[model samples]
Target: MTKVRTINNYTGIDTRSAIGTVDHPLANMDHAPTISELCKVFLKDGVALAVNASRKALHEAQLSPLDITHVVSTTCTNSANPGFDHFVCKELGITQPVEKVLLHGIGCSGGLASLRTAANLALGSSFRKRRARALVIALEISSLLVRSELDSINDSQDTRIGVTLFSDCASAAILCNGFGGVEAEPVYELLGWDNRVIADTEHDLGFDVDPLGWKVVLSPRVPKLTSAAVSPTFNKLLQSLPKLPPHYKTASDFDWALHPGGATILSGVEKAMNITPEHMRASYDTYINHGNSSSATIFSVMDRLRQKDMDKLAPDGKAKDFVVGCAFGPGIVIEMCMLKRNMSHIQRTLVVESGEATPSHTESERSEGEAGQEIEIQIEMGSMEGKDEELGEKLRDMHPEVPQQGDSLSEALNGVELD
Candidate 1:
């Protein structure tokens, strides 16, 4: 039998740029009260960003809480007993079944792993037995794991690459057996999945669970490893297919939705798979603005594509085929999915605003940061749905001791107790 589809997705980001940064470090932390306080500042930010994303999906798709059947949450950053999966159910007023999966110590690629799991569940389960719907949320707080004291950040060598390159983010995606209210035309069919774990690379990229939090020890050889495996795996995937599309030249030929592992990782993949500049820009820009929010990073890029008005950009009805998404993790494994783009008017304009107005962030709040220190966080929340002060109040009330204006959000979050 044909399986259900992943219909809609939403992304979110929380960083100094979006939320006011403070010198204390803890100020910019995620405001949700359930998680450990020892978490890296970025984790909280990432979750907040992800929350907005889930909200956006519910609002934009006009999906009611009762319509949702399952909630699958993915994260490698932080996990509390009553995790965000439950928070999502509670906050969204979704009384449906919620399953929270912490892909802890797994690394960045876990998002795809979770997606595959969700897809399989939807495919395997009996839709007739019960309404089958699943929502997957991937939130990465890489910022929380950065060790400023580590030689990587302290030393100017390749070690510092990890701390400086990683940012914080969160993303929420909804997958269901039916499209609910919208026309029944499915977006992406559930094609077969192919995943491979490179052997003996466990030490290459893993986390150190210490008193501070999850510290990433990513090997410099990561990009090379990624470059080495991508082509063969891709070719092997193509071989399995009965007929290959002539349009497929390289990994870049299709729309690339790869995890923004880092700028260098992207460059390596670009060289390895012949990815074009346009294809890589989304990943790179997401990393630059929001850093790496783990699973959420890819969705952020997708959301940007959605926001860029791809339809207006390609109005000739020349739809793209075989969109590929890849994510990497601890096993030095690559998880990839191939899907076809659905450029139907409803899908295209579903999230697009009626007016062609350029979205704006209120510039009047620029003075919120400290003197002489420029904030480097990405405020990729797109157009403001509510006032920054409203979010600021929520944050301040969550952490009353932290001053609103400071060097960075991390500094403010320094004092919060995760235990």
Candidate 2:
């Protein structure tokens, strides 16, 4: 029998403070700083974020420093000597000789690309006996490099959209062969991973790095080109999957966890994929609140889904086949992952492997609603500050198990309980 693999745990950090944003002290600065200055801010924020997220992941997963054998550090916004990987290990007191992989140069999609690479390493590497684990972190401090309005010399309005749409954040995901006792959902086997280059679109997006830091090169045409390519590329991905639902519409068929590349890109993708605008509210929420945290943006969406699922488990649940994630990287590539919700699976509510009981779920009941009303509402409770604990508790109280949460799909799955 083939062994199964699952993500043991996930942890994240938002590092927007060390940079200049609308709220940062330097936000009102007159000119874009030199590349070196950009580097300084980026490195500082990146290192701090990497360290924090690493600690959180290990703590939540309840894994010691030595438990991690490989480290994959991903960032498109920053790089340095004793790079993020080294800095993170050092800061976290992780003595394990972490093999490093820096995923820079690629744009937003790089996060998923890193995920694919890390997954391959976990599945194919000879680490099973050693119980070696791979930790992948996607960190982006986009706001740091954003151009200032006062500094705008001869730039077009479209040029600023990139900076406006991006926010800062870091997300850590782990792929373990078999950690002694890590509880997670079923092994969502890695289907086929593929990539394609949109010829002539290279001019659409990239960075010009020098002494002045990364000067973003974003084209207004990005949305149009992306919209054109989505249909074909998504179709190719579906054909590669061994099993696809008959009800599948197109690549844009389900609820999406997309990189908040910007409102424009999101609009383009929805049109290209033929998905309803409402299907992408999660992505929009991330954009509005977090901006564009590069590779880590998708995780924000995943975190939302995880929280929602945990908060809404029905006493008698149904299945979920409604979520998918995608991002855009270098070569203007799109990285995609599909999630299928299974109700029978048993999963913990909010306690991470780090053993911090953020929240725990119990059974709860609500009255059946009238027709045309969507009872299941996934709110980003903690996206704002000072509400993490309360939001977590809310999730646990409502969704305790997969089966019960799944019951939201059917009227017959309800039980009686008064408020």
Candidate 3:
């Protein structure tokens, strides 16, 4: 479980420098391409960006295209026919029969969802035979969705607020299990992941697709609804960890990559999760500089974390350092994951001295069986029924065209297989 590693990560640059101008990360698309034009430009440019980003990641990790066994990508911007995933594989010159998963519909949460799905693939037996290496990509072209027209005061407000923070972005990460990392730098291992759907919030966020293009929906009540739903779910996830004591929190060592859906959304998550603003500096910085490029935003934030030096996540006595990723999207979905950094030489020495295989969660304690800690999360959600033209188009729900690679930790630990 500890071997799963983020070998390298990269973010795409907007070819259309005019997109993110002085004020907004994504300038108004009033003079931008039409739906058909945007689709063509976006896919072409997005694919190139993704491929180059992947190349950069592989280069930095000193890996080759032959090292990658699978390709996974997620996006809500535009759904293509062959899917740009094929392009990624083709560009990387990966001729082997690599597994591929291209997810759509899910918005901001799709990044973490993609990583989680890749983690499952890495852990599964089918893909774990020799080694597991997967590339995860997220791209968003909000400028294409930017609109000057509005149908209602709601639409006007949404576009106005949306344009202020939305941008064009693409990010790629290489994840491998066991033999993933050879460098001594700190490693981010996927520990666990959980997701929750806030009932009745479909309209809170989504793309209103038509023959013209897509329009973003930004409900004003998002903060209240999101906070109410996220509070308990966040708590529920913490309590689900194995070694973690139920209802125990002291000094926080978790490096959070909370999706910056917006400024208010950040505050809402903090209020709901009881994490201070300091924990979300990465998210805020991304928002201010890159805007909410949908699913790709989290990676930019993680890049900031990496730049600031991730060694802090290494163990320091009882001060545990962790990486937590969170994102919310259409369907009122909340995706989250907890990742622990690979032990540095010092940390390995300390753990060996303590005779523990993993970090201990002895900072706090709670009752073993404290009745039921269930807390219902409520929010206004509504699926866009008629807007099916977007997702329901050529790419419907298509599961990965491969068998399971490995099992979850509960089913069978990949410890031996990975090592």
Clashes (N, CA, C under 3 Å) per candidate: 32, 27, 14
RMSD of 1: 15.8
lDDT of 3 by residue, 206-322 (tens): 767655456666565566776677656656667777675433453245657788775556666666666655565556546544567788777766655443232222223122346
Backbone clashes (count) for model 2: 27
Q: In model 2, where is the ten-residue run with the lowest total lDDT?
A: 1-10
Question: Hey, what RMSD does candidate 2 come out at?
Answer: 15.6
Candidate 1, residue 189: the lDDT equals 40
Better of 1 and 2 by lDDT: 2
- Local distance difference test values of all predictions, in order: 0.51, 0.53, 0.56
Output the TM-score of candidate 3.
Answer: 0.68
Off by over 4 Å in 2: 1-31, 126-132, 147-150, 154-159, 179-190, 244-253, 309-319, 341-419
Per-residue lDDT tens digits for candidate 1, residues 302-322, read 555433333222213232555
Model 3 per-residue lDDT at 212 = 49
TM-score of each: 0.69, 0.70, 0.68
| Among all candidates shown, the one with the greatest TM-score | 2
Estimate the overall C-alpha local distance difference test score of candidate 3. 0.56
